[model samples]
Target: MKPTGNTILVTGGTSGIGRALAEAFHARGNQVIVAGRRQALLDELAAQRPGLVGWPLDLDDPASLRRLADAVRERFPALNVLVASAGISRPEDMAGDCWDGFDAEAIVTTNVLGVLRATAAFLPMLKRRPHATIMATSSSLAFVPRADFPAYCASKAFLHSWLQSLRHQLRKVPVEVLELAPPYVRTELTGRGQAGDPRAMPLDAHVAEVMALLGRQDHPRGEVLVERDHARRWAERAGRYDATFVAMNPD
Candidate 1:
């Protein structure tokens, strides 16, 4: 789908990749709506971008998602694109006795369930447009598991699978499904340690690659591996990806 002149809503637009995408879309002259749970952040984004709309949405809550759908229909009925960029990452030590605690649950609820909620809520609106598209953010970890961040990886893997299936199912519809699989990048979601890590791509560089990828008519079957990186390529090396992961994390 063409990037410009479309009305788009990006969930988790308060920070990280979501915010960067919102800014990019706004700059391209699209009607961009930034949705997130934080009202203050939404206000800040609106203050910065004149035509941008900021909507407070909590994807974790189904009722809230439903309400958001109604709001979008009433306020921005021409909405034709959704960027499921809202997500969370946590080091899930499943070996620990407290695996059932809040952190693990929060990760699942926000990363996995939240995507599902947003998709279902806005699907009807997307259907209204003749050339709509849904972009789901997967990750390099979706292909290669980081043992320590198992929960986050699993959620992304599930989304990747779901997007693949959704793409097949929507073949007859105007709505297009695209999966964006990013490698580690310099962003707040990666934690401060990842900020200084040489392996992480600069935030601007990562988003620029993604923007170029999205501009193309070709939608990658399962993933769009942004720019070449050893770690990212190794993540998809079939059954052998594990050995590469171990080598990188060797103690």
Candidate 2:
């Protein structure tokens, strides 16, 4: 996927990695439309960045996603990049109270179902571009599940599977599906208290690497894992990787 000279739509652009990516592309001379659930945040983004467009969006609802699609088609028909980055993450334990179960549902609905809905809505418009790119934000947990956030990990794993299937299906089309699995990042999603965790990577640091990866002509699909240790562990020994994850978090 080319870095600049393309119209892009980044979901969840209000904050976190999504915001960083939107700013990165905008700095590189790309027309960026930042979409999220909060109008106030959108307004703030628009106010802060000249030529940056912001649209209020709710990813969980298909109707809202379709409406956003229609708006995009009408306004920016040449949009070539669709970044499905808007999602929520929460620790969920099935054995806990009702809130825990609710947390699982909310995470799955937003992370998995939201991506599916948004992709279906904008797919037709994306095909019109020469080299369209569909980028979804997965997680390192997708490869190795984290016991604390069971649903979050599973949802990201589902995204990895879904994007792989979508990439195959779009082989004949102009669109290219890319799954970006980030390691723990210092974002609001991780909570303020967890930001300083040694395992967590800085958001700006990760975004820089992502920008470099996306600039390449031959961007790899399926799962693009970040953070050296995770990549190395997964690459060197598949059996060991599985064993480590299972051992660390026994069911």
Candidate 2 residue-wise lDDT at 193 = 62
Superposing every Cα of model 2 onto the true structure, what RMSD results?
2.2
lDDT tens digits by residue: candidate 2, 170-245: 8999888888888778888958866676667888898888887677643444455555436622742665776667
lDDT of 1 by residue, 108-173 (tens): 899888888888888878987966999988887877777788788888889889998999998888
Model 2 clash tally, residue pairs = 0
- Can you give the lDDT of residue 52 in candidate 1? 97
Give the whole-model CA lDDT for all candidates, comma-separated.
Answer: 0.84, 0.83
Show model 1 residue runs off by greater than 4 Å: 229-239
TM-score of each: 0.92, 0.91
Residue 179, model 2, lDDT: 86
Q: Which stretches of candidate 2 lie over 4 Å from their true place?
A: 97-100, 229-236, 246-251
